[model samples]
Target: MSALLLDTAPLRSSPEYRRLWIGLTLAGVGSQLGVTAVALQVYELTRSSFAVGLVGLVSFVPLVVLGLYGGALVDAHDRRRVIVLSSAALLVASVLIAGQAWLDVGSVVLLLGLVALQSAAFAVNSPARTAIIPMLVPVEQLPAANALGTLSMNLGVTVGPLVGGLLVGTVGFGPAYTIDVVTLLVALVTVLSLPPLPPLGGARKAGLASVLEGLRLLRGWRNVRMTFLLDICAMVLSQPRALFPAVGAVLIGGGATTAGVLASSVAVGSVLASLVSGPLGRVHRHGVAIAVSVAAWGAAIVAFGLVLLLASPSAAHTGSVTSTAVPWASWHLWAACTALAAAGAADAVSSVFRQTVLQSAAPDWARGRLQGVFIVVVAGGPRLGDLVAGADADALGEALAAVVGGVACVLAVVVLMAWQRGFLRYDARDPVP
Candidate 1:
């Protein structure tokens, strides 16, 4: 039982890591609150789902550009300083968002711009923070550390939406944004406490040449390259996350309440998976584990699609598309939520392995660059997936689109596995990055 539990060695081994984890967990929850509030606020501003989708479109470019450049910057300077400055940028972005809400600003364009700024800050912040983890913990404990990281992230994801919904419904968007600002301060203090983390020798000046060098390193690192490739496959193929709003209203017969539940259900599963991920730390074949977990994710998504398909067409197509609530009381709603939960759990498992593989395999000097690419794949793949899933959903019904996407996801894994024989046989005992 002890071995089957999450390893706490990283926290026990470093007080700085412990503080960083706690601070990040709280800050993450706060950030989620703002994200949910913004989505709701945007919908209120313009009753068009297309307008809401534009929010994602607005942020994607900055995130990709900054994510790559940020990785180079992380390697070129003190990671702690980079993180501190990025956190401050995020704080500023949050304050602007709150100010707009408090002022009752009526422009959706301004809101989109703020979100893009926030996303750019996040693009810089994530790689530096993730790269810092390897420096804090030993190689053998990378899996556990990664699991703990995922746990905090999912906790925030699960609670943030619920809290955001309540705050927006009761107090309004201003208070929700205010809460994020307060939480950001807490995270900022914790990051300030972290000791200076200068990069090892070979860090070049932060510029185009540096960014290209990182890309060059990424291209040659087989295992690191495989991790990014496989991750993109999982995210691009089966990520119908953008459709949750529609699923709740039409396919599931509930309104916004159902959509909220469906969205959070995935996080709930992720939290649960992390809690019991003790045995995962003992596993040796991380690559295989990632592949299997993603495959399971696809299978679970397929089940969710079936649930939507089996529902009556009347219920599947009726209801106001806006994220306003109708109570969710149907058993079918529960089934759909359950499937989403399963998919979320599988995704969490895959994420832990993928992160562990990258952190453990990459050299210290190159870790930041690889982690940057990892962040890009993590942030960008889903946006690309939204384009894929959204187009499919529009062409075919959402249910059939999901079915096809899930099947494509599984097939994608199989094809990648065949092409990369090295990844299929990768052993945690003898890692080869």
Candidate 2:
């Protein structure tokens, strides 16, 4: 049982890692709070869902534009310094958000601008922070460390929005933003305590040349590249989040509340998987683990689509009060949630190993750059998935769209494995990236 639970070896062995983990977990919660508050505020001001969506647009643009440059900056400067500076920028952005809210400035434009600034700071801060993890923990402990990280993120996603909604409903947006500011202070203090972490070997000046240099290295690092490709396939081809609203309304016999529940189900599975990830450390063939986990994710998604298909015949009756009022007891709803939870669990496992491979196998000098590209793929892939899922649903019903997407994801993995047969043999004991 002990071996089956979360491995605390990384936390117990490294005081720095322990502190950093705590701080990051707290900050992640606060970040989510701010995000929720901003979106809600935008909706309140403009009363348009599109305006709320524009927040994501503004945030994503900065993240994609600055993600690589931030990685280059991480390689060029002291990682600790880079983190501190970016964190400070985040603090300033949060303050501006809070200030505007408190001052009763109801400008959607200002709010969107502040969100962009926050996203830009996060783009830089994330890579530096992730790159610093390898320096704090031993190679063997990378999986556990990353599992803990994933757990933290899922927890934040689970808890933060609920708290933010409550605060926004009761106190107002200002208090939620204030809470975020306080959390950022805690994160900054923890980061400040870390020792200097300059680039390994030598530093390259941060510029386009340095960014190109990092991309050039991917040509030789087949295993590390494969990690990103597999993740992209899983997220882009199999993600079904965009279908949640329609699923709840038509097939599931519920409204917005059901959609929220469906969304939370994924995070619940991620958290549960992370809690029982102790056994993951015993596995050394990271490449095989990732492949199997992604395949499992696709399979689970297929199962979810099947459940939706089974429920489709009842769409006409779903609008009746009996179905919406008591949707929890509906077998179809439970089955769909179960399938999504399973998919989330598989995704969490895949993320742990994929992150481990990238952190442990990549050279320290290029770790930041790789991590930067990682942020891009992780952020961009889901958006693409949402687009594809939406379009497919429009063309061939939601259930069939999900089915096609999951099948494509599985086939993509098989093709990748066939093309890069060496990736399957990649061993954690002898990382070849």
Tens digit per residue, CA lDDT, model 2, 1-433: 8999998888999998988888888888888777667756764565344454466567767887788899999989999899999999999999999999999999999998998899899999988889989889998788889999999887775566556655665677789899999999998998888888888887879999988888888899899999989998988788776666566556775543455456566767888999999999889998999999999989988998999888864645443211234377889889888998898899899999989899988888899999998887776566457667766877787798889999999999999999999999999999889
Which 10 successive residues of model 1 have the least lDDT summed? Answer: 315-324
Candidate 1 Cα lDDT to native: 0.80
- The list of candidate 1 runs beyond 4 A from truth reads 46-49, 312-326
Q: In model 2, state the lDDT of residue 106.
A: 95
**Backbone N/Cα/C clashes per model:** 2, 0
List the candidate 2 regions with Cα displacement exceeding 4 Å: 33-58, 94-114, 161-182, 243-257, 309-327, 390-401
What is candidate 2's local distance difference test score? 0.81
lDDT on C-alpha atoms for all candidate structures = 0.80, 0.81
lDDT of 1 by residue, 139-199 (tens): 7778888999999998887888767766765677789899999999899999999999999
RMSD of each: 2.3, 4.2
